[model samples]
Target: MQSPLRHGRAALGTTIATGALAALSQAPERASRLFRHRFPTVAVTGMTGVGKTRLADRLSRRASAEGTQDVGSAVMERRTRRDPRMRGYRFRVVPGENAATRLGALDEVFHDEPVDGVLHVVAYGHATPRRTAGTSGAGAATREEQLAAELEDWSITAHRIAGMAVRRDRPTWLVIAVTKADLFADDIDAAVDYYSPGSGSPFADKLDELRALAGGAKLSIDVLPVCAQGGGRKSSMPEKAATELLNRLELRLAQLSGHV
Candidate 1:
């Protein structure tokens, strides 16, 4: 019933409004891309039973609230996560049960995208047992033996990462996340010092080797203690420690991204 001029004006107005809405919807994404640094991709890696998956789940906002379930050997594929606190950053978890799978996961990550950093998780003699009954040498290893084996695994992983960095000719950041601090809550300082670089620990020696392998490639390394499941399983770490850990992690990620 409307006149042709009025109908045309109405149509034009509708078009203009829709275009404006579309632009407004896209503005956030555009602004993010413009102001944010390149997406920082980090790989969470360590020997099996070292709480890598749990730590990843705890940091990621998208992870289920029910908690992460245990996996056999290692996760079949790398799981990616994004923390709300770490905007424009991605954390990828790679399996590390054995040399083949560990190296393969790292290769897959490098092939898929350039990694900005790595979180090498360690438990400092409190990692869950990897073997069960009926397996040869199962339960025979003492805690000291287990820790030694894990340190050996760390050496291998570090060497592999250094090789990858040298090949890519890119600077890499490594954070040794000493997980399960709750187990040794009484002597947390000793636990941290044991893994700290230049502490004269075996782990420190391996870190020196990693640096040597990295050669001209810039490698920044840091050691941090974390209790991923604070308040769970009679955890000695208080909730405050968990909060502080997250804050420190956020600050470290920000620093790596040059946001600090």
Candidate 2:
């Protein structure tokens, strides 16, 4: 017994309410999409036990609870409460121990779908037992030999990245994170100088070659000294370094994305 006008008004109100509810339901997804568009994926790569995950944990303000080393790969999608602007970084961490996993991760991040940037981590003289094992199963390798092997690993990783850049025909932003700076706190400057570009070391030479291999594409490289776990149990160096690194990383990403 309702009038036509009243019926139409009721139907229209119902439609509007339904639409409002639908939009409200989709707000979170829409926000997620927007956040992803702003903050894209970044690959955190390096040799095993170099503190890549620890650094990511620190940057994302997540507790470093896992004592067991990462074996495969993981994507950290949580937004950091400490730096909201640094939120939403899809930090894909791949294992650096196994050759199969390392190559697979590199291909996933570089060959399959290239990420925004790469953080190639290194810990000076922090050789793992496996890495230091003698080729003939004789004994542990000498410290100098271990250091050489680490540099060789860095070379291989850098070359792979350069190859990917060439294939993608795009600029690449590479940050060489010299982690475990706390181990050499008394001579931090020397440590930084050792790994820095133009230091005349083999590492620097390899970096030069990497840049050359990039051809016309821009290769933005940075060497950062970091202590992902701080100098000691009570040191605040990790927090400070994490903050500085995040700030610099934001700028680097902005530059890479042409948002600068």
Candidate 3:
């Protein structure tokens, strides 16, 4: 079935990059400066099943109606067709996992490559355990405990990345994308509407706490709600996630140019 909503430009390829450049070209000074360096790289990372692979598949224009399988540690590059100078923009997707491996992967990105941004993809659904027989306790307690654990995991990821950003000589931006928002559409007016304080979702409260943690570490950070998969009951689409990611690339590239 055809989607009713028109996808905003497909996956930041030539046409989209050209359009982005056109917008930046309006300010010739910035455009000229920004194009002087090789394109920046952003890494998509998070816990397993948080939708990192799906996000990468959609961004790479490889998404299908059903879904995409997990591809570990994939590297894809994009360059503006009009100008070779704006070349080598890359997205290196490191498979999502818990704190044990997330930190190691992040450490590599920071030390091994000159990464301009990091996309920390997390899912709201992680808080809700899958239904099964012979459950351990009341559903609410289970959910609450699940959310708390998720928060701890996310905080560890954020703390490690923020620590790297603070100590690294070069500057980097961290864009936190809360994925799987569509699954909870009824509860949230927007992606994060349910994540707000007092919303009773530990995920929301923890997200708020993450910001303070970032500030304390002095890392540039921003968070957005995204449905990488379509916006239906358990639907998956990457249009919004792709658009937001592209926007972040443009913004981060420009910022990095000044410091370069």
CA lDDT of each prediction against the hidden true structure: 0.74, 0.68, 0.55
Better candidate number, 2 or 3, judged by TM-score? 2
Tell me how candidate 2 scores on lDDT: 0.68
- What range of 10 consecutive residues in model 1 has the weakest lDDT sum? 67-76
- Model 3: lDDT of residue 142: 51
**Candidate 2 RMSD to the real structure:** 7.3
The per-candidate count of clashes, in order, stands at 0, 0, 6
TM-score of 3: 0.55
Per residue, candidate 2 scores C-alpha lDDT tens digits across 1-260 of: 99999999999999999999999999999997677566766778776656777767765667877664332233332323224455456677766665676777777887787776787777776544352434543235555665686787787678778877887655678887777766665666776677777888877778788888886357788777776654434564655654565566556656665555
Task: Give per-residue CA lDDT, model 1, range 108-215, as digits (tens).
Answer: 665555577888888888777766646754344577987898898887777668767787755788888888887888887888888877889998888888888886
Q: What is the TM-score of each candidate against the true structure?
A: 0.74, 0.69, 0.55
lDDT of 3 by residue, 88-193 (tens): 4456666454344555666666556536677777666553333234765423435445555557666666666665565666556666676666565454355455
Query: Model 2, poorest ten-residue lDDT window?
Result: 72-81
Judging by TM-score, tell me the better candidate of 1 and 3: 1
Clash tally for model 3 = 6
